[model samples]
Target chain A: MAKKRILIAKPGLDGHDRGAKYVARALKDAGYEVIYTGIRQTPEAIVSTAIQEDVDFIGLSLLSGAHNELFPRVVELLDNKGAEDIIVFGGGVIPIDDFDYLKSKGVKAIFTPGAQIKDIIDFIELQN
Target chain B: MSLNEIIAKKFSSWEKNVLEKLLKKFPERQKEFLTASSEKVERLYLPFENEQEKYIRDLGFPGEFPFTRGIQPTMFRGRLWTMRQYAGFGTAEESNQRYKFLLSQGQTGLSIAFDLPTQIGYDSDHPMSEGEVGKVGVAIDSLKDMEILFDGIPLDKVSTSMTINAPASVLLAMYIAVGEKQGVPREKLQGTIQNDILKEYVARGTYIFPPEPSMRLITNIFEYCSGELKNFNTISISGYHIREAGSTAVQEVAFTLSNGIEYVKAAVNAGLDVDSFAGRLSFFFNAHNDLFEEVAKFRAARRIWAKIMRDKFSAKNEKSLLLRFHTQTGGSTLTAQQPDNNIVRVAIQTLAAVLGGTQSLHTNSRDEALALPTEDSVRIALRTQQIVGYESGVTNTVDPLGGSYFVESLTDSIESEAQTYISKIESLGGMISAIEKGFIQKEIQDSAYKYQKDIESNERIVVGVNKFSVEEKPPKGLLRVDPKLRDLQIKKTTEVKKNRNNEKVKKNLSALKVASSDPNANLMPFIVDAVKEYATLGEICSVLRETFGEYKENIVL
Candidate 1:
């Protein structure tokens, strides 16, 4: 089977990339080809990276409380580009109160802090 | 037989006769025990039969040279560590309310948290700052916002620590201006500006200018503060972000001290006296889950710094050798699953910090891992420190864990290990070259990955994460910043620009640019002048960004 490709990206101005980097490395270790966009990326930049890489999933991580704005923007951009099939998931210091809203806006899974790598991998594997 | 030989023999005999037999029937829970940093835990620690000479040389009395036990003679007995909660969110008006509330609830000091745009030298209205205004911290675009941020609060009465870097000079200038407005002179202002940028290049990602200009700005602050803001802490060489970015306790101490060395060297090279500025240098560290290791890390840091100042720099002032520091409970240790459990985690970390003889501390709120902490959570965090300071009897004595065999041995081990890392950094042409070459970043990432792998493999247990699993509802009442905040801040910045004297603002900014272009010129006065003219942070930063250029990070992972 061809390896599932995933792009791990940090959007907005936050530099707290420990969680993003950890998940990126873990996904790579779990036999997925991962492309990580470093901190302070724009939603347009992320959408372009995902399309250019032709990845199956985009993992958006933000910790600066801009997830409500940035995460939905990424999903909307992907949809506007007719790339809605490219699954978008999110993580970081996101409050649970925003989960249903984010999921409703096209984020497949919302991983808050304390989410295990196995859980993330399982979510990805289940998508298959 | 000598005492060392006899103890060694007795230890081996006891291990063989008593431990092996007991282990055969009731085996230990795990094959090996390890600390949060993944260092091995010894089965037992015994006193080494050292002569009285070693004690006198290594572990001296408190408030003396080579202050290993504690920095002050009375320690907490004379004064308890200041409970400074790191708080700020939303607009200046909103955050000011929070600060006032904290003061009313008995917070002794204020630690200002600035939003990402402000930390990165952007005003609230910048295109890049969209959706990010006042999310993580308070947003201040000019002197107007700063004035409102500290309105009605007497500057001389409370010590304030502003976690600002890259643009630290501008923020400090605004602070001084605010003091002047309150009839308090610059010299009477007491506070700290987290002017450390080396750590930003390696751990936090708030850096703006490249290293050459960044170091110059730091040295400029050192020189400026020595002559003017004598009571202000010019720089807080920090390891808290380094640890939060996932370095071990030893690496935290080593890398932070190495950065300190780089800063001192830069100041001396800039023709400043070492004693003139070294006395004002402070440190910030993180307190993690491991009680003994964290305690040992703090103690080892003090001893190592004292030795470095005395032996390496030949610092003459007694104040130069003291390693006064503030500690914050580990933010990464908080679990998002069982939010209530974090209160317990914070309490343990609070005890570890107090036991380590910290000069001040910030306790992480229970909901920090999820969102900005609510008022209830912040109060609990503050109360955690108060209970440890007043209720816990650990404050009765100085360096209460000084002579314990386990703590002493651990302290020595940590000090030696940290020294090894520092020597390697020194050999690599100090911390800047090390960071530029990606050595420090790689080491931290490797440790971070290993830590995550251990947790996933069930080798390390984070309560409510890898072990002691539970099913629970999602957390409620997580603090949310209003989306309209960005608009309001943008309007304020626009109004300030429209109302202020545009000609004077232009002159000040151009003067700043000219000063920035000169290698020998100190940029503090120029920055202060620009700030007082209602020059927006983005405008001022753009002027320097054109001159100094922005820093491009070396992404290690």
Candidate 2:
């Protein structure tokens, strides 16, 4: 199979990117093409990067407690552009109550900290 | 036989008879064990085998020269480490309530966490600040918001530490103006600004202007504080964010001290005497999980800083040689899987920080890995420190772990490794050049990568992560900031801008713009004047952006 293109983008002002980079590297090592837009990316920048990179999945990471506003905004932006199939997934310092709310808003999956990299890979494979 | 020879002989026989026998039956857990700093741990530490001569030279009594044991002679017995919790979120009014609550609960100091917009020098109303205002911390746009934030708090009585960078000058200027309003003279102001911007380039990503102008702004604060706010710590040379950004304990020490070196150099080059400002110089560090390693890191930091001040810069004042630091238990260590386990993790880290002799401390809450800590969680975090202070019995003596054979060795090891890193930065033409070359970022990325790999591979076991995790119901009751805060803050900023005398604000900002280009001119007075005129932080910093320009990071990965 051709390598699945994935864009690991940080959407918001949170500079803590260890998780995002870690997932990107893991995806790359698992034979996926990964494009990581660096920190402080806005929703528009993230959506535009997804469209430009033509990625199969968008892995959004945020830790600054701006996940509720920024993460859904990315999904909503993708939906407005008819790029809903881009498969938005995310992980951050998100509360449990927000998980169903996020999933209902088109976030395909949500991973919290201490989540295994392999589980993320499995989640992506299931989506495909 | 000599005492050293006899001890060596006994250790050899014990290894063969006891250690080897146990290993043969049950097998060793791993081929080798390493600390968080990648230092190999010996199975046993013997007196003659360790560095005795170096210990006598380096690990002198508490409050003595070099200050390896502790800075104060009495340590905690004189007064306990100030239990300061880093708190802020939503509107200024809400955050002020939280501060008052903490103070009532026995918090000795106040540490404010600013929102992303405020931290990056943007007013809450700015288009770029949409969806981010008051999400992570309190949003302040003008003196109005700052005035409300400290509404009832006496400025001179409480020590405040604001974790703001890039826009540190604006915040400090506003603070001085607030102090003036409160009938507290500038000299009576006690606070610290996280003005260390080089780390923003190396670790954190909230940098506004480039390194050159950032250093200029920092030196301006140093000079201003030296002349006026004598009790205020102009800049907190911080490693808390560095460690949170995924650096080893050694890198945390080395890079933090290296950044400190750059600031001192810049201030001295700005024609300020080192001793005049260095006495009020404070440090912020992260206390991680490893008990001895964390303790050793603190000791090493103090010793190295003392040597640098006394020898390298020839600082005459004894206070200049004293490295007073505040520590926060590592936030990155909090595990979301077993949120309750984080309490124990914080306790261990808090003990390490106390034993390490931190002047002030903040213990991370259990639910922080999920969201901003709620009132209950914050109280528990504060109680963890109190239990250690009142009940733990470890505080009765200073540097209780001082003469441990293992601790002394680890202290020396970390100090030497950190010195090597400083030397490398010096060779690369100091921290700015090294950061521009992406050397420092690459080092941190590499360290973070290795650490994550170790956790992933179970080489380093984080309990409830790789080891003892049980299926947990998702954590509930995590604190959530009100979404309407964005609009409220924007409205507040709009009102301030509309009501302030436009011509005066305009003239003061333009003067600030003119002064931004001059190397010799101190910009603090101009910033303070503009802040007094109710000029928004964005307006003042926008002038600087036009003059010095924003910094773009050269991300290595």
Specify the highest-DockQ model's number. 1
Per-candidate alpha-carbon RMSD to the true structure: 1.2, 1.5
Ten contiguous residues with the weakest lDDT in model 1 chain B = B46-55
Considering the two chains of model 2, state its CAPRI-style docking category.
medium
Instruction: Give me candidate 1's TM-score against the actual structure.
Output: 0.98
List of chain A TM-scores, every candidate: 0.98, 0.97
Off by over 4 Å in 1: none
Per residue, candidate 2 scores C-alpha lDDT tens digits across B361-476 of 99999988888999999999999999999999999999999888899888888999999999999999999999999888888878888888889998899999999989888777
Clashing pairs in 1: none
- Spell out the clash pairs found in candidate 2: none
TM-score of each: 0.98, 0.97
For model 2 chain B, the run of ten residues with the poorest summed lDDT: B46-55
Interface RMSD over true interface Cα atoms for each candidate: 0.9, 1.3
Complex DockQ, candidate 1: 0.79
TM-score of chain B of each: 0.99, 0.98
Measured against the true two-chain complex, the DockQ scores of the candidates, in the order shown, are 0.79, 0.69
Tens-place lDDT digits, model 1, residues B124-196: 8777798899999999999999999999899999999999999999999999989988999889999999999
